[model samples]
Target: MAFSTPRVRAVRHALTAGLLAVAAGLSGMAQAQSSTPIKLLVGFPAGAGTDAIARMLGEKLKDELGTPIVVENRAGAGGQIAAQALKAAPADGHTLFLTHDHSISILPQVVKNPGFNPSNDFVPVAGFATFANVLAVSGATPAKTIDEYVKWVKTQRDGKDTIGVPAPGSIPEFLVKMIGDKYKLDLQAAPYRGSAPMTADMLGNQISAGIASVPDFIENHKAGKVRIVAVIGAKRQPLLPTIPTFSELGFPNLDDYPYYGVFAPVGTPQPVIDRFGTALQKVLAMPDIKQKLTTLGLNVAYEPQGQFAGRVRTYTQSWERIIQASGFVPK
Candidate 1:
């Protein structure tokens, strides 16, 4: 109470310096925590569907955060490379995996030792896209529909004709077997690394038919190189109004359309997860994103963490049955 003016000024200066130090430390911590650019790792090569979607979202994420977003293509092994990379990432939310059901749902069923656990090693970020696969035949083939395709295969298979699948135990392979079994075709199913390679074979006459996402063949099929035998969703894809759904052809249960989603490495903080989800929701709502996906035959859908987790669990159960029913085993 009786301090001199100089003493009081010295105390005030010390207090001010301490406050500034604390403020600076907190600001630096904030920047370190979540303000940096993020890497969106895609498990497919450029021009692939997953890569395209990741780039679209990465651009929006960059805009929304004022940070750069890089989409690194880590192709091969049906996403095992990307999945394993995600498994080893820092889980700091600055790196994420953008993948389809194959890596998340089918791989566990396909590989005996996949090297990563999707359920325990990753946190669901968002599920924002779904692709309805179709059974397609080469234009050189005489099939116009799934029924026609099966019947024609019986006519011309002549002991051996191939139905190209992205890979055995992949979602596309499952669809191929389902339709083949349903129609009693028993045609050979040939597996490839990804849809791109499979489509190459289908178009080059190396394979007579293929089970692939609608987007994969929409252009070539329209141009007369390939044709959709049947779509695997319950209803017709809005993008391809002319393509008939499996249900429309009396297999309503072929409604299991495949989806794509993002997941951060396990242990990423909850706040970071929230930031990603919010930015992604805005991206998904963009008019251009919706239009582009639809035009490519992907139906846009978004689910936040909780719903996406539920879907992961729900589809886990469903695909186990499908894989078993389809007589597929990891080998």
Candidate 2:
């Protein structure tokens, strides 16, 4: 038995085409595995402390991991949008969220359905730093001390005041309510998308005071544009040594510090998580890196994934009690 010339040629052509197709598929898979840039997602706009740190680490991580890293800002809804984005991303370790306590620890507790849960939807990659939030007043505000500010709010502002916050339902908002109750003044929170805008309002006297992390206000405070009157922590921060801690000011319950960290979508391989954790440790260990982050107001430190996750759990539980005591019903 023999095949016709046309049939034989057709069979050869089919075999050649099949081999070429398989090679192309393999090449595509290799490129997908090797060349796609890892995205470091931030829940706030660029120029805020979180975004600044993420970009800094992303630059160094490119060298450490020998791959390109892209910092993507998906800033909105108190980081809910970014958290949801992380949940929707593939669990291949290519996407990670860089956020602070507001998003990971507090948001889910406050919002009825935040679209994702930290324990269920994401895995901690590492913890980098802890920081205290500060209460800062505008340069034009006559008050300097927390006592003086309270007095001014009573006497100068007719017992009512508005303080800008970086986000609604954020720690700062709760602080606004607590401060009002403590001092017996009508204080309300004017929430902004991020600290940059909130600071801008404070500068223009659009809002007389604001509460945000030290890094957000440190530069301005040093410039004599914003006045940091009170800080929240067990001890006074080195950057604002003169400022009194809330504990010193008689509000001991608001002293727990918040953290900055990274997270990957759940189900990401542990080895990939470890690789990132190791790179982050190296980045945090550099003297220059530590100095820069310290200058930016982060108490630069590194915790591996397990320790980081535990910290998140503890912080979340603590805030849960605080929120309940405040009578805050989740929205």
Candidate 3:
């Protein structure tokens, strides 16, 4: 195996140099990650709550990761489109998906043969924050608390119990179903394209009650146009201290609420995922960002990559039962 020929020696030297050059280039790129812009793909329209959070996190992630982060809206199918897009993209860490439980967990349970598999096709990067789903009654409604609302719902005529939820299989819809079942209340569930439409209908008295994420109605509730009777959380949101959560109402099993987080495509290097998660956790710890998210009534939930991945698995299983229990069908 000893090659003394000049030609063999020259070939070996060229191969070693080529490998060194490649290694050096990779190291230089990692050092210059600040100059490369990262993409954050959201599965909702611009101006939506998820989009807003994405923008906020992007602003902070850009500062921490030293890379300019850009948010791209790929809206449709309760975030399935964005999830699908992530699955189709290369497993590079450059493209990231900032989505919630709906896109990753709920949608797949309802849809038949969804193109993307959340747990298998993606890796959880960081979990940022969580907001409760507030049970809001339109101004025209004559009830304020869950007890009163339950009584009112029972009194409604067969067709008068229309409750406007964001979508048929969304988290909000599932909440309404869970509570309605617990209280033995009759409700006619109605679906909307998004929270904006449902909020509008609630104001117009088209739907007696609406269940949406607290961020969607926080402003209107503050203005007194809509009232938050109950929030689905372990405790009241700090901004809405007076509003009692379902657990406070004695529904201990209904305490934990939905969460949102960032995910990278599968096969992404563990180092990149760790770096991204660390930078995001730091971003969540910033005082200014914390104040801003708190103003939107969201609690900081900066779970690291491992724990966040574990929660995703638990949430997926829990909601599989809830979705099937609700009998929600995509088509």
lDDT by residue for model 2 (254-323), tens: 7678999999999876667888889899999999899999999999889999898898898888888888
What's each prediction's clash count? 0, 0, 0
By TM-score, how accurate is candidate 1?
0.86
Which candidate number would show the highest lDDT if scored against the true structure?
A: 2
TM-score of each: 0.86, 0.89, 0.87
Which structure is stronger by lDDT: 2 or 3? 2
Better model by lDDT, 1 or 3? Answer: 3
Cα lDDT, all candidates: 0.81, 0.89, 0.81
RMSD of 1: 7.4
Evaluate residue 55 in candidate 3 and report its C-alpha lDDT on the 0 to 100 scale. 98
- Backbone clashes (count) for model 1: 0
Error of 3 at 159 (Å): 7.8
In candidate 3, which residue ranges exceed 4 Å CA deviation? 1-34, 156-159, 250-252, 327-331
Quote model 3's TM-score.
0.87
